[model samples]
Every structure is written in structure tokens, then in C-alpha cells.
Target: MHSSSVSGSRPCLHSFKTTLPLKALAFSTMMLPLHSINASKATYQFDTVVNQNRLIVVSVENPTTVFDKTTHLHGFGYDLVRSYANSLNVKLEFRTVKDNASALNMVKSGKANFAMTTASFQAIEDKHLAGFSATCDDSSVLEDNGLNVNLNWVFKHANDPLSQNASAYICNTKQNGTISQLASFYNRNVVKDESWDIIQRDLTNRMPIYKASFQSTAETYDIDWHLLAAIGYQESYLKPNSVSPTGVRGLMMLTHNTAKAMGVNDRTDPSQSIEGGAKYYDLMLNRYSNISYPDRNWYALVAYNMGPGAVSQIQSRLKAQGKNPNSWINLYSYLERHKASNSRYGQATQYVTRIRAYLEHIKSTPQLVNL
Candidate 1:
């Protein structure tokens, strides 16, 4: 329910092009819990389909078309909706489903507050069951032979009392506060990184091959080893031969020009790619050095995926709104609502979220300590 207004005129900033820190505080392995203070304990008389303290978002994995699986719920739609929930001081609970049809059924059945698996309301087989929020990412939905082809939208059960709340919050025109600035109203606790015993179990075989390279690269770049490994896992799942559809190659998915710039001759070489990506990541970190811990790495990862220019533009926008552009959570709210398509806000946010999830997983792994 909390909100702020952004100025209509967008300001441009070029200061982000300056030098960044080559070193950063090592990411803490200690896990922290999110804020859960309810000392005053004010209860709301009206509790809609959404839980009083949480929002249940139904979705399915559709990386290219919807939510990025690597990051869980960090896509454009997810970010936008989640930001709204956060504004209301509610935690988000994402429910994975088999498909959009099933997602709609969940909402219709009152199981979830909304169905947000990149479905266009117009294309739904049963349109009467749900209503969609005003499309934020585009002007109108595109139809390919009467089926949703291109358009991003979310839906809630037509009968759900919280549907209006969902609509108002999702498409609400307001300024999102930066993390550093949110102490005024943000009451949630911060969650600490968890142990990655599960990830280590899965990576047992590959650890022997890449552990040394991960350690060496991390040291050379003055970054956490797990970060490098997390990026590798997200980009190509630690497969040295992996190549992205856009021509990014190798374990870290370095593009041709990026590889050359980093002095990498063989993009497919695991060691070489890891080194190059690490160096590039370190450089990115330096650029956002002014940003605080956690957020610094978050911005760097976004820059690494979407390029520094896009992130720079985002920072500038945040600054124009009298916000701390250095705060990722603050930026997430703005990025979620931004109308511009070129910024790649959705993809960049998702990329960072996924990298963070992986980093946390790796940090939790006790085996990494030995390396």
C-alpha cells in the first residue's frame, strides 16, 4: 500500500562510465533471515485470496518466454508483481505448475492469487474464469492465429476479491524506494545465504575438474570463488562446450568480442573462459563500487548479462527520482515499472537473481571451504 511518485522527466547520467573497484568484500557464507518484526501486531480485517502475510503466485518454467528458471521468479512480470507485494509488506510464494492452462485453473479454484506464466488473457481457452492486469510491458497483446504469441500479462481469478489489489499494485504508477532508503517502512528481515550441501552433491564430479580454476580465477579477480562458479553454472551449466544461441561460447558463455577483449583465444576452453569472465566481472564490480555490499555484486551480474550501458541507464533513472541508484531492491521496483523495452530490465533482473541463488547455493557447500 506504500508508494512514491517519480518525476515525469527522465534524467540522463554518464558518471557510471568511471572506474570501479577491483576488489570487494567477500560474500558472507553466513545465512541471514529476512526481517519478521510484528511487535505492534496490527491485523487487517480484510484478507482476500492472498494470505495476510504472503502472496501466492502461480507460474511455470518458460525461460525465453516467461520466468527464468535459474532465478526462480525474477522475470519482468514476476519482478513487477513481487515489487507490489513487497510494497504491501507481504512475502511472495511462487507456485510452479505444469502449464498456463493449469495456472489458470489454480487461480479459478482459489488456490493462487494470480496466474502469471506469461499468458495473454485473450488467448486463454476460458476467458470468463479470470481477469488480467493492464498490460505494463506492451501496448497490446499480440495474437498468432487466435493464440497468444507475443505479449506479457498476469491474471487473477475473476471472483477473487484481491484481484483489484493485484491490478492496482501491479500497474500502479509509483516510485520504488532503494534498499538503503526503505528502512522507514520496510519491516522484513534479511535472509542469510544457506549451505549448499545439495549443490555440492550434484557437482561432485565436476568439482575436481574446475575447483582449481574457480579458486585461481576468484583470487586473481579478488572475488568470491562461488560467484565465478555460479555465473558459470547459470550461463552454461558448467559445460565447457556450451554455446548460447546468441553466439556466447564456453563454460562462462563469453561472446566473441568479449573473449577477444579479455585476451581469450579459445572461448571453448574452460580455464580460459573462466579467467576471462572473472576478469570482466571484476571490472564490472569496480564500475559499481559506490553501491553497497550484496547490491554491488547484484548490479555487476546484471551488467555482465545486459551490458554496463543498460545498467548505467537504469542507475541514472533511479538518481533522477531522488533515489539511491546503488540499491538493487530500489532499482527493481523502477525497473519493474519502466515502459522502455530496450533496457532489458526483466532479463537483467532475472540474470542477477539467478546468479545470486547459485552463489548462495555454492557458498552453503562446505566442500568449497577446503578449496
Candidate 2:
């Protein structure tokens, strides 16, 4: 959250008018020595040179609505500024405002380089700011009638140097490839569109099913029946009585050692095997807390299929490459890079890749949820 009030008043300057054109005024003002400014003017002359390379501080809130991991920041205001900076060869900095009020104040006080969010025009119009670029097209339904609340980018006073450059770029660029890639990733990960819903309906009609459990000391943990069924599908196509050539057993496919650690009396028991498998998954998730969620879920699934230590080694390699240790792309890329090598690391990468692809397939299909 942020305070609604401005922290301090802006300094006032005496009024002055310049006959010079905008570009000339900008050039003349920039040429004047930094400390030698004519202090009496209400409107200071703009400085194109100094302002051209200036850093634009774009603000967003935590749990940023602008850029989820799958969605690139380029689709949002961040990308707008980034493109501007690239064109101008200037620098851009991102600041996370504590909340909406702070974001508003940042624009009002000229503290922010620029600000955008899912912000409504009415909420910020009175601040003497320039609202350019509308982001969201519509608002949530209200009373069954279509309602619309526009999301916009806010700049300081209309001709503020930062605002000028940002506006120019926003007017020119069409959606970039970065935006498409991000949208694709988001669709794959978070937003299961209409196709997925249809698949879920079909799967429901089919009701392809399996079951598993874990029991120890007189206590029983029956896995979510559907989850157990999904896991069975992934492991052995719901083969309740199946056994791996490597000595894993049952519908959930627990090894004898894993069954022992989970206190499962029998690896062959469907209920026990499922329970042990789910417990092992829980343990993997706990082990990788530093990884982001949803992604962490994917990594844990991979680690469950491959060992945790092996995943840790891959994470180490990813960190060395300046990639996110927990990101699926980074991990997947590393896996592909190492797949042909005969080294132990290469073998681990191969295993992780297979597990990730399996998880991706499972997520893509509609047989599982609550993942």
C-alpha cells in the first residue's frame, strides 16, 4: 500500500515566456551551464540532449499485473519504454511502486519517469498529467451490462521530455514478436483457452480412471482420486498392476526404496504406491522453494521423475549461464544443449527434459487440474 498524499510541495518559479521554437528552446536551455539557469522563469526551457539519454522510471505494483513470467514485459508499458529507449539509445529503469496511490503520486510529483498499470482515467485525470496509450480494452461485467474502464499510461506535464519521447514511440510501433512469444507462453501456462475447456468436457465424458493410496501405522492417506489417476496416466497409462523393468511397481509406480521411505508397506499396492508418489512430490516441492510457483510446480514434477540432486546440478549450470535457475525455458534450453553429451550432467539434462515435456503435455491436456 502507499500513502495518498504528496510528501512535499514542488518549488515554484517565476513566470517567463520564450519566443523560441520548441526545438530551439530545448537546445538553448540545454546549452546553459547546469547551475546558471535563469531562476526567474516559470517554465524552464526543455533540454533535448540531457533529456534524450535520461532514464525513464516506470512503476508497477508487486505481483505485477504487467508482466507474468510467461508474458514478456514488452507487451505492457515496460516494453513501450524499452522500445523508446532502444530507439533513442537512452536508458530505462523499472521501479515497483508500493500501490496505486504511490503510482499516482509518482506521476503527479514528476518522481516517476512514467507510470502505467491497469489504472482508470477518472482516478488520475485531476493530477495535471498526460494520459497517453490505453492498455485494457474492456472492464469486468457489471449488472449483466457491458462496462468498460480504460487502462492508460500516465506521463508528467504534457511536454515533459520523457513524455514526448514515449508518446512518439507508442504512436509508431506495432505489436512486436516479443509480445507474441509472451502471449503464447502465457496461453500455454496460465490461460487455458476454449480448446482446453472442450478437451476437459470430453475427458469428463470418457471418465478414464485409476486409483492409488498410502498407509502406515494404521493411518491412511488416500491421494486425490483424480490426481492419482492422472499420475497413473503419466507413469504407465493407468496400469494399476504394472511393473517397470527397473523394479518400480503399481499404478503410481513407486520403487521399493521410495515405498520404504514413505512408510508404504507394499510398493505393489495401488493405494500405497499412489500415496508414496504424492508424498515424494510434496517433498520435491518443499526442496525447491526458491523457484517461482507454477514453475516450481513444473520443476518439482521434473525432479520427481529425475532425482532432486540431478535437478539441483542443472540449476547450478543454468545460474552459470546468467539464466533463471528455475525457469522452464532456461532449463529446457540447457537440457537440449546437453542432450548429446555422454557425460553424467548430460544424462541428467536428458532426464529432466523428458520429465518437463511430460509435465507440459499433461498440463496441455485436460485430464489434470489442481496441479
Candidate 3:
């Protein structure tokens, strides 16, 4: 059978399909349900992968893979494939690969339709066949012979174990949970828990005093006021009298030197502190101007905590490794995989993550705005 042809080639950042027999095998494996193959293949003019009665996806077990302990078969790749399978009302068959070579070999050998590997694109490019990863956003799909085979290739650490059984990489998804649930596992649910009612109420009461400062400073910086508010709350519960053991003072917790650098005469003054912090944050955002949204904001928060110089160094290292240094997710992953002694990855992660959570909470609590 003559397979559909592809004109331009792009690196499959998140996913890819094979050529020749491998392509044929992918179609055969992915379009398992007879009903689907018979029902849509003719109209779509493509071998059914999404709406097929059965969908097959192959991936190696690693940190980025989403696996369910109860099911033990599906990982991150499974979750991604499951989303399509669920949407198409199809059944999914999850397959495993031993290593990067073996994972792609599944595609080459026709045992699996598509594969997911948490190995770096550069490593894959160096070791395996040719494939291009375009732009380095979240995930890139592989297109072959006009077939978009959904491959979830999450890059892995260099020191990660060779075998799934031996690997200790953090799998971010589980077979039992929905996509929202999986996302929550990684990004964390920012909403406030009702259990913290008293603390939240106290914080809500204190919002009015500094709300204007946050609003004005955030507006001046063209930033979300809630973000500044969240940072203020996290730093000192929005209290101007607060001081840290490290001698950082004020609602935004700037050290004496940083306060001077930002032209703030009083670090303990809520308005000056908020303005200085916002100005400093604006600087970080400008420095990482090329990074995309949400990720850029998250990276800026990291730079705010760990300093821009440290983040810049990490970004350079990421670029050297053929990864996008502008991506907060990629940077975080790199930091997690390769421990950074110069930067406080854990502390910074918590700081940014908590601020995000607080920001979400504040956004949801419009009543707090009234206060």
C-alpha cells in the first residue's frame, strides 16, 4: 500500500512516526479495532490512530513517564495516548521499551506504533536516526508519510538508569488519573483548601492595607497585581514589619543591598518594597524575554529568588545540551535531574510554586479584593 507522503520535515519534539515498513507497522498496530479501521479510514484518507477501536503506544519507563502502580503498564506516554483514545472511544494497549535505542527500535521493528522516551533530543539525534525538534515548546508531534504519530518523547537525565526496572526518574502521570489530575500532580493545584480557613481569613483581612501598593506597582510594571500580592504574602504575609534571618526585610523581602540597588530608601516600607520588587521582577522578565508565557513568568520568579546570574548560567548549560533554556519547565527539569549547587533549586521551586498557588488563591478570592 502506498503510504501518504510528507513534504517538509520537522523534529518531533514530543512525538514522531517511522518510515517504510515501520510506518506500515505503526498503522497496523495503532488501528487495531476493526470497527474503527472500517468506519473512518476511508473518509479520513488516513490510517486511523485516534478514533480506532484500539490504539497502541510504546514508551520507556522513566521519570517523565506517567505510570499507574495498579496498572503498571502505562506511563506518561500512556496518559497522552489515553487522552486521544478516550476522546475517540478507543481501547489502548501500552507497550514498554528498554532504552532509547530500543524505544525507537520498536518503531523501526514495527512492534509498536509510536514511542515515548525521556531522553534528550540531542542525545537521540546523536545516537539514533535523524529527527528535528522544532522550537522546543512543551511537546512536538512527529509527522511521517502524512501520518501524525503521537509520540511523547520527554527528555531524560544523562545519569538515568538504562532499564525501566532500574530507573528512578519521577513519573508525572498515572494511568488511573485524568489529564487534569495528572497536571495537578506536576503544576500543583493553586486553589485554597477550605481547611486553612482561619489563616486565609487573616490574610484576607490584611490585604486592604497594601493592596493599593501592589496594584500601582504591578500596573507600573505591566504585570498582574495578584502576582505581586502573592509574592508579598509569601515573603512576609504582607506585613511590612517582617524581617528574615538572612536580614531580608519588608513585604517583598529585599536585602539592604538589593533595596539600595532598586533605589528603595526603606526596605520595610510596603510601597517602596512592592515597587522595588516589581521593578526587579520586570528586569528578570526582560532578561528572559524570549521565553514563552507562564514558563517565562515562572522562570522570572526563579530568577527573583535565585538571582538572574544563576538562571542565566543554567540556561547556557541547557542550550549547550541542545535544550531550550528559555523554558521554565525544561530549566526546572534540568535542575531536578542535575543538582545545581550554585542555585537553591528546591527552595526556589517551593518559592515559585507557592507564589503560584497563592496567586491562584487570590484570583479566586475576589472578596479579598473588596477588603
Candidate 1: misplaced stretches above 4 Å? 1-202, 339-343, 367-371
Which residue pairs clash within candidate 2? 14-42, 213-271, 213-272
Q: Write the per-residue lDDT of candidate 1 for residues 63-95, one digit (tens) a residue.
A: 322334332233334444555565566677777
Q: Model 2: residues >4 Å from true position, as ranges?
A: 1-228, 342-371
Candidate 2 global CA lDDT score? 0.49
Q: Which ten residues in a row have the lowest lDDT in candidate 1?
A: 6-15
Tell me which of candidates 2 and 3 scores higher on lDDT: 3
lDDT of 2 at 74: 23
Tell me the alpha-carbon RMSD of every candidate.
16.2, 13.0, 15.6
lDDT of each: 0.56, 0.49, 0.56
Clashes per candidate, residues 3 or more apart or on different chains: 16, 3, 14
What's each prediction's TM-score?
A: 0.48, 0.42, 0.53
Tens-place lDDT digits, model 2, residues 127-147: 655555332121221111211
